[model samples]
Target: MARNRYSFLVKLPTAIALIAAADQLFLGTAIGSWIGALALGWILALLLSRPALRRRPSLVALAVAAGFTGVLAHAPSLLGWVLFWSALSIAALMPRIGRFDDAWRWGLRLLAHAMTGPLAPLLDGIRLFRARPRRGRPSSSGLAALLVLPLAMTGLFLALFASANPLIARGLTQVSLPSSFSVIFWALVLLVVWPSLRPTRWATRIVARMPSADIELPGLPQATLLLSLILFNAVFALQNGLDLAFLWSGAALPEGVTLADYAHRGAYPLIATALLAGLFVLVALKPGSASAANPAIRRLVVLWVAQNLLLVASSILRTLDYVEAYSLTGFRIAALAWMGLVAIGLVLICWRMLAGRSAAWLINANALMAALALGAASVVDLDASAAAWNVRHAREVGGRGVELDLCYLSWTGPSSLLSLIELERRPLPPRFRDRVRYVRAEVLETLVRRQADWRSWTWRNQRRLDTARRLLGANPPAPAATWPGTHRECDGWIRDDPAPEPAPSVTSESDPVANAVATTTPPLTGTPSR
Candidate 1:
């Protein structure tokens, strides 16, 4: 008990110092390599509080590897953040894992620790305060007595001096203190860091209190289960058959239904259906139970699961078609990845049922697949990839894809740098070319200014800056007179009518749209007129 109490005391200052470092590193600047440094600081703070973790060198190494991955990319990803925190949480709980712990229960315990970690510091402070000896004089009132007289005298003198001396009064007024946000930022940092610094040991009880994984619920009756499976298969087969006809085999849709409408509607709802089907199979047909063991039910179950897999495949195809018809975004890419996960999950469920595996095994299998996918996703820049894809296939460049959406690329910020540069190099119509340059210049300027600060610097941005310099030369395009959201569309076409302010009367015959903001708006392919 004393050891646990002392651990918190020892780590409190470290936590405070890290909070200060976080404020310095993050408050004013965009996230960059600073995240790696902050992650490393938290790891060290955790190690300081619990020396035993040093003995588990492999876990320590894994934690360091995952944490550093935050800075490994040009910019940190959501995956990197999740991986960093997850590793720290696992490292904090390493000493608590027992020899007999199974993967599923241990994972649940890890989750419990995460949910309870932020509160652990307050809990510890309460425990320590309660455990102190009662024989000591009331230290709080005595300390207040000793400081109250000095504080009163200092306040009185400061007030008198401020009124008497103009210099003092002006100096007091000039004092620029931290804002309210600083205090909130510090408290938030404490909440994030405290858990890793001192993990709650009792989180084990959360997993302990959970019902045993081995407890089997009564299985559905074999005849009823078999009938359900047959009906489900037939129903799924109908959907799959329609998908095969219209989507796979390219049969024409009904007059009113376009392929995009068909593709968009089924992409997500079908995934939900597959998920619901998997849950039904898991709950109703336990691996070693009578329903699962029966030959007829097993056959029907296999057929239904196979049909579900086909349904998943169709969903994937539909999503791809939707992307081809419209344009790809990060969300669509994620949806595709999700479809893959669902397909993998359905297969794992079937494999578990046939092999007589436990629910724990099935969960562990699915989790492993998800972790692998997230790990891969962490390093790849989905936004950049999407931007680049759109640029490469844009109709402006005479490709089969839709016209480039500069608005989306603008929202994407620096991730669109390379793609914009690519678009600039491609052959385009004169007006389209001007708009492309205008949008590209806006994105590039922001990236350059952001990287100017050390706090916002990242390897990815630096690489892009270097490549851009080589391609476009040291001179960036002149800053557009009007930004995309202001007087122009993201595609850089000028608005039909200018802002309420009068346009400058001076216009050059040689270049009417060159001073677009000062004169008349330019004519472009899709600019709508009032």
Candidate 2:
């Protein structure tokens, strides 16, 4: 086996670091720290795969920009979490493969990159054995060195154990050294431990650069194309018609049907069906096929694709209606963006089939579209966005929405600081009011707590805390009041003194929204404020 010294240097640490970070038992599960570790591995992978980032402006920007987005994300959000891992893998592989831009194929190629590391250490062992002299017996001096070293270690350890020093005696007694003759342990280590220790070179310029020879694919038959399009259009029409009548026009569902049930059930599955339809269209109506050339079939394909687009529209409406009753979330935002991409992809598929674009063109176009979407998602702090939407649309607020989900809102962490502030200011009904107060207080204290260090600082967190602070400072929030029969766990509303009475009006920004505060009458006669 050919040895790559430089590659060995890069791969070993990278493999160890990645595997170690993923080993939750040892590292524990801290998302920020875990992602931070992966970020280092990403940089190593990029430098290993493409050393010439300076000369490659686009590559440099892609790497550096991705680094910022992943690292400085508002802690770890739903969108930020996915984008963070994906951006790392894509950054490592994009510069290597230019032929097929499919992410699925690239992911497979990345897995293949991982395989090369396994036998590397074994190769070194074999090479060393072969380089030795022709004698079957080992050299006297080398044999002595090996034997003497272990004996020396044993003597030193035994001396320390028997030493008068109490610290050394206790340290040696507490440590359990592995058995030297543990064949089972050695077997397990060789079979498992060794592979992960090795790292693979991202073989782009070598194996990846070689172009695969192409075979001429016969055009899809005329009959098959027409028949497939006819069948697909019929199927799509049925689905779309149902969606139009019930979803778009707000026709009643069968008895006992709620809007949320109707909307939630269809949102995800329809997107998947639309994606499959797009794939079928690509295959059945490949460019230059006899069916594609037929004007009548082309028209039918357009009609069918239009129906699929409508299906996408229905899915969006379904999700939006669902969100109105439910609250916004990271996955929900991603799902919305994903449905949009599917819609855009269907349009692109139509364009390709009509324009007779090459396969390469379709792949690259789709890849570019995906890259743009991911890049946009990376910078957006989804936790903050979701929190803001949920708080603004809460039933207590003026917007049409569900009762506040205080438990979930709390889990969103400091990104929801401003929204928690807004929730605190709103007058909630007695049942949810106390929970909201508790959640808001918990959220507020966490955000304003003493800094652990500069390492914990992030732009999203900083900006949000600043905004929450300014709002709190402008008007000291009312103390959390408890209704009769409500138990106080931690008494989060404890204050040094009562809030100051506000003057009639004060000079502030002219912005209506910024100056706005919801007026709420206290309905619950609670115990006097502390």
Q: Which has the greatest TM-score? A: 1
Measured on C-alpha atoms, candidate 1 has an lDDT of 0.79
What TM-score does candidate 2 reach?
Answer: 0.68
Q: Tens digits of per-residue lDDT for model 2 on 298-378?
A: 998899889989999999999998888787897899889999989999999999999998666776678788878876776
Per-candidate RMSD, Å: 9.6, 15.4
Shift of residue 431 alpha carbon in model 2, Å:
7.6
lDDT per residue as tens, model 1, 84-184: 67666666666666333455776787788878877887887777665543455443345557888999999899889999999999998998988999998
Error of 1 at 79 (Å): 3.9
Which residue pairs collide, candidate 2?
A: none
| TM-scores of the models, in the order given | 0.84, 0.68
